[model samples]
Target: MEVLLAVVIGTLYGGGLYLMMRRNLVQLIIGLGLLSHGANLLIFIAAGLRQGGAPIIAEGKKVFLTLPADPLPQALILTSIVISFAVTAFALVLFLRTYQEVGTNDLDEMKETDT
Candidate 1:
């Protein structure tokens, strides 16, 4: 499972980078999203995949009887998801406005127009 997840994370990172190198603004935004997702997954996998109980102590228990799942990565992923979503939305809106004003989605064309 870990190996599979590693492959998936690698793929996401690779695809994201590949798309980001394209000349299309839309593809760049998509690549950014993919890269964020890959980072989230990497954090999750780095925290370790274990079959354990929730990270909560039972009532009247001084300590956990079983291994508890790490909550830090989960919290981090959630926070990152929200951040990525906001960034992507903002980028989309900005790109859309630029497209409307510039009449092009190609980065090369946009750059050329700046001259």
Candidate 2:
């Protein structure tokens, strides 16, 4: 499972970078999204994969008798997801405005329009 996840992460990073190098503004935004997703998955895998109970002590228990699932990674992933969504949304809006003002989505073409 871990191996599969590693492969997936690698693929995501590779694809994201590939797209980001293109001249299209939309593709760059998509690549950014992919990169963010890959980072989230990397954090998840780094935290370890296991099946365990929640990270909470039982009633009147001094300590946990068994290993509990880690919550830090979950929280990080959730926060990352929200941040990524916001970034993507902002990027899309920016792209749209740029397209309207510059009349082009191609990075090279936009440069030509610069005064």
Candidate 3:
């Protein structure tokens, strides 16, 4: 199961990077989405898989496998996901505006301030 998750994460990361290298703004957005998912999956897998876990409490005694999954990673991933969504939305809007004003989606055609 862990192996499978690792494979999935790897595939996603690879595909995201491949897409990100393209000149199209839409493809770049898609790549970022894929990359975010891959990162989330990596964090989840790193937390390990536990079927049963004891509740968190003071003076609570529990073993490693019997304890609840780490909450930190979950929280971080959730926050990251939310931030990613916001960023993606902003990027999409910006991309659309750029497309309209510049008349192209090719990033390479964009000129720097100095140019």
Candidate 4:
């Protein structure tokens, strides 16, 4: 499972970087989204995959009995996902409005509008 996830994450990162280097405004945003997803998955996998075991012990028990899944990584990823979503939405709106005024979705053309 981890191997599969690693491959997927690598693919997403690769595609995201490829799209990010392009000239299209939409593709850049898509790349950013993909990049965020890849990052989130990386974090998740780095935390390790566990099932049916307690990774943490009870408050009073010091023998490390029972294994439970760690919630930190999941919580962190959830927060990151929300932040990435808002950032993506904002980027889309900004790019769309800029494109409308600049008359093109190409970054080269949009750059000319700054002056």
Candidate 5:
């Protein structure tokens, strides 16, 4: 499962990077979203994949159960998800405004106007 997740992470990162390098604003936004997902997955995998109950300890226990699931990654991922959503929304709004103002969706074409 870890290996499979790793492969998926790599693929997401690679594809995201490829898209981010393109000249289209829409693709770049999608790439950024992919990259965000990849990062979250990476963090999850790093925290380990266990088959235990909650991290809370029992009455006589000093710590979590042997191989208890880590909550940090979940928390981090949740926070990141919210942040990414907001960022993506803002980016899309900016992109749309820019497109409307510049009358084009191509970054290359936008550069020509600066001259």
Candidate 6:
């Protein structure tokens, strides 16, 4: 089960990176989203695969049968996701504005031009 999850996460991350290298801005945004999901999944999986039990700690709890999830990784992934979203949004807006100003979506065509 862990190996399956790892493979899935790895594929997503790899595909995302590949898409991010594409010339299209939309594809890049998609890649960023995929990357974020993969990262979140990876973090979740890294917390350890437990059989059963709640993660919350009750008052005066003696012992836990199952391993508790690592909250730190989840927190980190959340922050990273939010930051990635902001960056992706900014990039999309910039792409739109660039299209409006330059009249083309082809990045190669937008290369520095001489007057």
Error of 6 at 67 (Å): 3.6
Candidate 6 lDDT (Cα, 0 to 1):
0.81
Q: How would you encode candidate 5's per-residue C-alpha lDDT over 7-103 as one tens digit per residue?
A: 9999999999999999998998999999999999998999898788888888897876576788888999999999999999999999999999998
The alpha-carbon lDDT assigned to residue 18 of candidate 1 equals 99
> Residue by residue across 1-115, what tens digits does model 1's lDDT show?
9999999999999999999999999999999999999999999999999989998999999999898989899999999999999999999999999999999998988665464
Predicted structure 4: lDDT: 0.90
lDDT of 3 by residue, 1-115 (tens): 9999999999999999999999998999999999999999998889886655544654553545355656777788999999999999998999899999999998788876544
Q: What's model 4's lDDT at 49?
A: 85
Per-residue CA lDDT of model 6 for 55-79, tens digit only, reads 6666687776576665677678889
The TM-score, computed over Cα atoms with residue i paired to residue i, of candidate 2 is: 0.93
Error of 3 at 13 (Å): 0.7
* lDDT per residue (tens digit) for residues 40-100 in model 2: 9999999999889999999999998789989999999999999999989998999999999
In terms of TM-score, the best-performing candidate is 1
Query: Which has the higher lDDT value, candidate number 3 or candidate number 4?
Result: 4
Cα lDDT, all candidates: 0.95, 0.94, 0.87, 0.90, 0.92, 0.81
Candidate 2 vs. truth: CA RMSD?
Answer: 1.8
Q: Give the clash total for candidate 6.
A: 0
Span of 10 residues, lowest total lDDT, candidate 6: 49-58
Q: Which segments of model 3 are wrong by more than 4 Å?
A: 57-65, 112-115
Better of 2 and 5 by lDDT: 2
Residue range 11-89, candidate 4, lDDT tens digits? 9999999999999999999999999999999999999988846566768978667577788999999999999999999
Q: How do the candidates rank by lDDT, highest first? A: 1, 2, 5, 4, 3, 6
Models 1 onward score TM values of 0.94, 0.93, 0.83, 0.85, 0.89, 0.74
